[model samples]
Target: MTSRRPLSFWIKWLLLIALVLGIALGVTRALGKRKATSEAARATAESLQKTPTYTLSSTDVVTVQSIELTQTVALSGSVDALQTAAIKARTAGEIQGLSKREGDPVKAGEVVARIDSTEAQARVRQTARQAESAQAQVAIAKRTFDNNQALVRQGFISSTALDTATANLSSAEATHQAALAALDIARKSLADTTLRSPLTGQISARLVQNGERVAIDTRVFDVVDLTGFELEAAIAPADAVAVKVGQTARLTVEGLSEPVQATVARINPSVQAASRSVLVYLRVPALPGMRQGLFAQGHIVIGGVTALAVPVSAVRNDKPQPYVQVVREGAVVHVPLQPGATGLKGTEPMRAVEGLPAGTQLLRAQAGLIREGTAVRLSAPATVSN
Candidate 1:
């Protein structure tokens, strides 16, 4: 009624109204699409919730069986001669000759090497002559004492003179004894010049050569008794408490094809400062071709205990808490477990688990896929090997 004259103005108003109506229709269509999508998703979820689970057969399960779990402590060590002798020169002398060389088999009391015994021999002879002179002096003193005694009884000499003679005889006897002891010492020094092996073994090294002058306590040879071997194994202090004398171990040497058996000979009381381990000495069986200084590794079986366990394949660890799937009364049950040790069972890996009783049926393979309340058929379960 105010200004209906301009047709352009009327067209503009009509356009504006059409644009608003279009926007409203678009928004309504968008809302309808969103509602339809939400309804479809809800329907799909309900259908999935109502779907029946598939049943797994007993063949797909592993029965948790009673197993003998042998606990072992790992050990590493080196091979050594059971008895080793470090030969040294007791007396200083020139190495005139060596009777044995490296790898030479020696016997107890054997002369392995000889020093320059010429000086020693000369000293021994001189000592012997002195000893002989001392003996002569003692004999003469004894004669003088006897003569003085007879003279004193016959009144030929005074009592004081007799006493003087006795005193002289005692002095002579003491001097003779001193000379004899000196001679004995000289003889010992002479014997020491000839180096002798205290034990029967093979010479592992020769430190001195002929014509070489050596001082006292100088190393001459290294002899090792190859008849038997020893293993010095270092074990953790915690496990070493269980180790005792006479406990046996199976050892593997570097070159040996089969494991050698050894008996625990000794155990160190104090822990090693650097390694924080205890030293355990084991005596290895003396077999052919066994040598010293070879590296070895072994295990000490502590004891065996019965435990309910399953193969390692049955345990699933993908979740925050490790668990295993078990089939009970025709339904799958999710069981969270406290797993103990792995690699306890022979060749095949097995796991020690708690919170599960014996005869529990666990899935044989891929237990992670199992869900709670899933249906399962009770068929004959597969036996867990060990």
Candidate 2:
């Protein structure tokens, strides 16, 4: 630079200074843009922190309280008639006079159907005639034996001849006894042609037509008593230990509006091999419009307890630990919970929980999910138990 430079050289130097100045200006503009972006981001975060995330009403909050809870075990099964009978054919023949159909009322000892009695009647007549003939033979044998006895006493006949007469009389008497037995059997067969209802109930099924021939022991009709009902349920082996006879339950049956009451009637001592469950039978009082095979579900009241609890719907499992959304200083806070037994508080399902003090307010399930530290505004503060 000390030496006088050429014009071209000076022009190159000038171009270099211009390029450096442009670079510096571009970097300064870029830094200002970055600082502006950071300030805008910080402002947005502050605004979100100040505004309420959710507005909760009094109904959306539940309060922890000490309550009397009825502990219950869930159960489900089908409603069945207490007494059921399968009317079967006692003798094989063509079915006749089967006027009873499904839903028809039946009385105990009522004739539900009849089998064709032609063969049975004929057998009875033949056996009766044979019985009469045997009776005459028996009378004749007695007379001969009596005569032999008199002759022997008077010495009108030899002792060997009397012995032979005695043998013949014994044989005739045995024959008459056998004939009478056959006649009684024939009469029973004739009586068996008529089928009668074994219980007072309604017919649930009809297996044969009037003209159909059925074999002995073939099922013909199914009868069920609707005056009393029972629910047959299977309980897990672990839970069966607490279930005892006389325990009460409330069941919601299919197609019925009102909940039906039931009492545990019986529990099987053995566990089922297939499902490893114990069978439990609950007796239900007969109600209008109740039917067999109606599906039912309910809970059995095992015991009761007084403890700090909340509604079951308030507990959430979305986090790594089970927690309930609690309101603290106008902000949503997730409090870890140690859930205990589940029960009912005046028909409202409640769950025993720890890690929260009594009278603490918590969000219900209907509030959905709110992030931790989110601001919450309560329109009206109230204590909702369930």
> lDDT per prediction?
0.82, 0.91
For each of the candidates, give the backbone clash count: 0, 0
TM-score of each prediction: 0.73, 0.90
What tens digits encode model 2's per-residue C-alpha lDDT throughout 1-386? Answer: 58786899989999999999999999999999999999999999999767756889988988788888999889999999999999999999999998988999999999999999999999999999998898898889889888988999999898887888889889888988999999999999999999999999999999999899999999999999999999999989888889999999999998899999999999999999999999999999899989999999999999999889988888898888888999999899998887498899878889898878898989999998899998888889757585
- Model 1 lDDT vs. the true structure? 0.82
Query: Per-residue lDDT tens digits of candidate 1, residues 1-386?
Result: 69567898889999999999999999999999999999999999999788686555545778787787766667887899978998899888898668787889999899888888888888889888888898898899899999999999999889998898899899888988888898898899999998888899999999878989999999999999888888888888888987888877777788889888888899988899999999999888878778889898877767666777778777777789888887778778888888486435654457788878887777877434767887766545555546
TM-score leader = 2
**Which residue pairs overlap in candidate 1's backbone?**
none
The C-alpha RMSD in Å for every predicted model, in order, reads 6.2, 3.3
